[model samples]
Target: MKIDREKLHSPFVEQVERVSGEVFANCYQCGNCTGGCPVSFAMDYGPSQIIRLLQLGQEQLVATANSMWLCVGCLQCYSRCPKGVSAASILEALRQMTLRKGEDHEDVGGLPFPFLKDAPQQAIISGFRKFVS
Candidate 1:
């Protein structure tokens, strides 16, 4: 991907930076975030990849990824980051952006009955909080 000046300074990037309060440019592709993430195994794109896509001005790709929705906001990424970039915060910004567009990441009605029945109440509530608008 050819990252040009226009892409780097794009409105989408600006909005993400403003909302996340973290500079994407500061991230240098270090994999600490993904390595430390407990739930990264279940994500389509790891935290580091999400930031990389954003850095490459691939906001549309980032927007379409399920990575942001899977983030548990544990801040393990932040704790392991050398530049103090919080992937959790970036994911939250992406989620906010998606929510602002009136799109829900998950459908409560579409959730599987087995998982719903077996999952802890707190986990279910947290899923609703994160996946619902």
Candidate 2:
């Protein structure tokens, strides 16, 4: 997508910063976060790409991606970030932003009871903490 010069001042960046508690403009697209992400294989856009999207103020992709839901809160991205971007926190912030719109990022409503039952308690509880109202 073409960069909009006017949108460089958009509210999207501030919202992300507010929720993520990081100065997102510091990100330099070094790809370190993506390289270190444990779950990057599961992400449509890995941590570095998400940070790049946020840095570019690409609100549409940043807010709507399934990548945020794919984050397992492993903090590998945060640890490897030389610029302290905390990409996982930005992902979590995006998830919270989606929830603030009264929409869920994860749709596990159709999962069989036994399937959920076999999952670890931490997984179930964390899912609730992240997904439930």
Candidate 3:
């Protein structure tokens, strides 16, 4: 597989820092964030690994991972971080970046009618905001 040097040359780390308002350098890989995350078991990469990837300017790896999309925004990571870095916010920034690039994580029209009917209104609305472009 060919790596995109252009993306590597881009200010990916700075952009993530700017968009998320969190410093990647502050993370010490303590694993507290991942340990505290309620949904870490379901993620392709834990919060610490994601932050490390960001620190190393591995945006493509971070972008391709399902970890960001799987983040539940529960703030457990932030609460557990000694530096108070918010991985949830970083994931949100990643999602926003993907959305701004015109990519939708979920197909709204493809949602099953039965599931839509059975799901709570709050869940449906939240899904739309999170998954739709």
Best by TM-score: 3
* Candidate 2 per-residue C-alpha lDDT over 1-133 given as tens digits, one digit per residue, 9 for 90 to 100: 9688655657877888898898877889899998988888888898889877777778888776778888989899889888877988888888888788878645678768997989998988888778855
lDDT of 2 at 129: 76
CA-lDDT, candidates in order:
0.90, 0.82, 0.87
Residues 16-37 of candidate 1 have per-residue lDDT tens digits of 9999999998999989999999
Give per-residue CA lDDT, model 3, range 15-72, as digits (tens).
8888999888889999999999999999888999899888767877888999978998
Reference-based TM-score of each model:
0.86, 0.87, 0.90
Give residue 108's lDDT in candidate 2 (0 to 100).
Answer: 73
Clashing pairs in 3: none
Our model 1 lands, by Cα RMSD against the true structure, at 2.0
RMSD of 2: 1.8
Misplaced by over 4 Å in model 2 are: none
